[model samples]
Target: MSWGFWRNWSIGTRMACIAMLPVVLLFASFMGYSWYSHRIQVDEELAERGRVLARALAETSEYNVISGNLSDLRLTIRGLVQSDASIYRVDIVDSSGHGLASVVSETALAPQRLQYGAPIRKQVIWINLFSDNGTPHITAPSDIRPPTVTTTNVGEVRVTMSPTYLLGKQARRFRVELAIAALALAASGVLAFLLARSLAVPLQEAIHALRAIRGGNYKVKLPVSTGGEVGDLQASIGDMAIALNLSKQDLENKVAERTRDLLASRNEALRADADKRKLIQKVNSIVEDERKSIAIEIHDELNASLIAARLESQSIAALAGKLNAATPAPEIEEIRLKAQAITKLTLDLYASGRRLVRRLRPEVLEMLGLHGAVEEMLRHYDSGSGCSFTFHSEGDFSRLGHDLAISAYRIVQEALSNVMKHAHAAHAQVSLVLQDDVLRIAVADDGAGFDPVLSSEGIGIIGMRERVYALAGTMAVHSTPGAGTEVGIVLPLEDRVNVS
Candidate 1:
């Protein structure tokens, strides 16, 4: 059998087999030896019995043979054969080696037989009456004589005995022995089964306990009922279960503690992020207020001064023009040229001031809402830059709050500026979509884009991202070298704007 096949047997079965096989084999060997010895002994006894019977028959038949009464000898031999079943046949032979009488048992068939022979002998006695001196003395000489005996072979008797009866007896003895051996084997088997069961029960319990431990259930109970290896194994498994359970409890406690700490840390991070965004929003509001104040100062003060200066220069130039018209003099020409230069300088300065005011705060944002302001900015970029620009808007942007409108306009303005300055493109598209409380802005350009990772963050892009984050929005820039750049921004209008 394969190892797998044997291994599949239960421990009790294996142990029982281990305990019983040797005894069974031993008993078998003993029975075989006993049978062989008994058979040999029976054969030897049969042969010996045959020899003794043949010798007795030969001695008794000598007189009969001399008297030539073979009928009586045959009758004696037949009676011997009939009396003992073991003697299958008997025969008598004369000195000439002729069979004179024979008897065969009626029951003798194809029986295994042993043959024995004995010789009948005749004896003659002789006496030496004279000594070697050839003198006999009645009372004077010390001469002595000895008697001699001579024996002659007369006839032989043969006995043939069958071993069937002895063998049958041996078989009966062997049967008794076999029955005893069988009883012993059965008793041993029962004892072995009991012993195996005692061992197997504890082992099975240990296996169950181990299975429970493997399944992560460390709570198990096993009793040390017996001693030796099984008991020791049970004790060890119980100890291991206790240790594992303790470890599991400790690990669970540590995990719970760590989870609490992680939750607190995550909450702290969220709070810090929210505070940062609020701070950024407040700073942006302050900066916007300052820009408005500066725009008002320059528009009200600086522009007035430049206009007054330009009028005075124009008056001086007119006076110089009249003098040149009357006297064609070099001093009159120099005065007129200087007055014209002063007026031109003042106009240029006033125009620069106006442009600066517009950059600081666009009056168009308040007048036309977010949509019109973006459209106007796009128009300004399209007219000034060599790159073409397209504007697309959806939904009502006029419902946007003042702060949100200004932030959106600035974000668009910054995006367009970056497109014109960095993106060497032939076409650019700007899209504004407001729907479902969300305002999405997309600015895409077919330009020689740069890698976002390799390029440093510019002030304009940073400012745009900060504004988006401050308003609790998300911004993403998609760009690759040799490809186009697309900036997408999503702002939740409901969160940032007051519709009324």
Candidate 2:
């Protein structure tokens, strides 16, 4: 079996195998040795017994064979065969190798048998001491031998034995040995089970405790019931849980403190941002008020002065014309020319004052509302710049508050300014939609667009963004290197006036 397979086995099962395998091997070895030894011993005993019986039979049958008493020898062999169940057969034969008598046992059932044979012999003696008395002593040494002894074969006996009885006895003994070995193996298994259970219980408890710790329950109670690795492990786990609990508590406290600090910092940042926006809006309002005052001053005082000068110049020019017509003088003509130049200069100055008033504060905005103002602005840009401009508006802008309208106009003005300055665009589109209490403004251009990220710091964009932010609106600029730039703005018209 693979080590991985064994490793996956439960501790109890592994321990049981560890405890029982060697015992099983030992028992098997013992049984094999016993069987081999017993078989060898049984075979040897059977051969020796058969040989002894054959030899005794052959010796006794010599007399019977010489006397020609075959009938008695057959009776004796038959009786011997009947007396021993191990003796399968017995035979007696004469010295000429002819069987004189044979008895086969009908009761012996063993398939294996052993055969032994012995020869019957007759004794002979010779005494020759007077012969060769005249022979030389050296040559005829010991002419009178102690006595010649010889034996002649008279008959033979054969015995065949079966080992069934011996095998049956050996089988009985082996059964007893096997039974004892089995009992031993069973006892060992029981002991191993108990031992494994003892270890597994603690291990399972450790696993449970570790699982609890992993699940963030560090308050588990583990009793140290034993001394050794298991007890040490339990104690260590308990300590670790306590330490972790403390660490978690400390970390939570620190997190709570950090969270409070972060919240305060965030509130401070928001307040600062709100204050900055308020300042910007206040500055813009003040600047607009100053511009309006300057425009009114220029329109009321400067335009009147220019108009009076133009009228005086016109009267002088008319007088010079009459004098020249009556007298036909070159001096009067020169005087008429100077008067005409003066009148033209005064008229140009008056026109310049009017244009300045419009630039300082657009009187068209108050007269025509936001839509008309935006359309007027687009027309101005389209006429001045080489770029084409398109203007589109939806919904009535009359409901818009004064501040929101001004801010919207300024935002659009700044956007168009940026487009004209940097976009190098062929065409630009401006859309203003007042819908659902929200004003959505989009300014798109097919121009040499710039990276919004790099150009975000431009004064024009920053001013536009600040104005939108002051009015609580959101503005986004989407552009790529080659693609056109589009500025999308969403201003909530409902509460926008309150935002400033």
Candidate 3:
């Protein structure tokens, strides 16, 4: 597995594996090197002792034997064995196959019986001291060297030192070293356990904390001072928790703010609608009252005046019927002038009254249609104001529904009225088009325009805005000071004529 992939493991397994791996590898290498060095030291000591015994026997015992006292051999060899407790045995043999003198009490010879000139095993470290036995067995210090040749002063002697005894001591020392190694290995296992526990415990706590947090316990906290990468992780999680809490709070606050704004806007719309309803009712009542009053005034007062002036003119013309055209008398001329003046004045007064009533509310808009009424009104405005006027239309005006026509008419009337009142305008243009179920109307004036922003105090402009709002249309008044104003309305052509 990749090293970094260990995190996917459970906390217990991960910590145990990671913490114990290096510790085990280190302890194994240490034990191996130590065992190797220890064995070398022990083996060197054994070889040194064996060599010393071989040299000592060659130098001391044989020289004495060269002086011709064979009995002295036993005494010197016996003294060498008494020097150390580690030596198990020492012995000497003759070339003629005689039993040798032994230093160890009740030590068995276990005779070596090798033929003359026979080769010895190398790893066995057998020295050739000849008791002249034909068989071979484990040799010792006395047997480590080549046998001496017979000479005149000394009879041929065979020395056999028991290396089996030295080997036994070596084995005992090796057993002690092995015991130390086992102890060391066991100690390493214990230390590794402690180290693994130190790492695993904190990690386990961290895992528990994570689980708790997952289960919705945000307050769960890991133990501090768990130094290293795990500690850093715990700290980062704590920071994330704090951030989550803050983000949640922020979201909640935003939702609350949006809700409050929505509620306030709804309340404002409700209030505007209530006020619009009341104003519409009041306007309807006023228009009904005005229509009644004007109908009565024209029928009674102005109609009587026109009938009287026409009669008076007709009476004078009849009375002067006999007068000649070429020699028309001064009385007839004066009477004709008086009668004509009265007739002209009566006609002008009648026309003026009609204009006043029509300005208030057009009867033509109710009769021939909104389109006819608008054209007539614009023609009147143009004739009176001495300003250029233009009207263009698209789509069938007859196909337009009542609500659409009325709204278009009201918007146009308001715009034109503004142009007449404040624009001091030289030119005005109005366009109405129906496209894609949307009614687009634009009224433009080349007037000495007022600032649109500063014009809100105007009831005339506010009335236009309110009317457009009531029609579910968007109105934009684009104007700059001393420049022209263009009022545009985009209304849905749904024809909701039930708006009354």
Give the number of the best model, judged by lDDT.
1
Runs of candidate 2 with Cα error greater than 4 angstroms are 1-21, 56-109, 120-150, 154-156, 319-339, 452-456, 496-500
Per-residue C-alpha lDDT of model 3 across residues 210-278, encoded as one tens digit per residue: 777678666666556477887787787777666766776788799999999999999998898868855
**TM-scores of all predicted structures:** 0.70, 0.80, 0.48
Clash count for each candidate, listed in order shown? 0, 0, 16
- Model 2 lDDT tens row, 374-477: 99999999895899998888997888888888889999999999998888999999999989899999999999888866765589988988888877789998
| 2 versus 3: better lDDT goes to | 2
lDDT of 1 at 264: 95
For residues 48-126, could you state the per-residue lDDT of candidate 1 as single tens digits? 8888998899889988988899999989998888888888888888899899998888865545545799999887788
RMSD of each: 5.6, 5.3, 13.9
Model 3 misplaced stretches (Cα beyond 4 Å)? 1-54, 57-275, 278-300, 303-348, 381-390, 399-407, 419-429, 434-440, 444-458, 471-500
* Error at 63, model 1, angstroms: 6.7
Model 1 spans > 4 angstroms off: 1-25, 42-110, 113-168, 182-200, 228-233, 296-323, 327-358, 362-402, 408-436, 441-466, 475-489, 495-500
Best by TM-score: 2
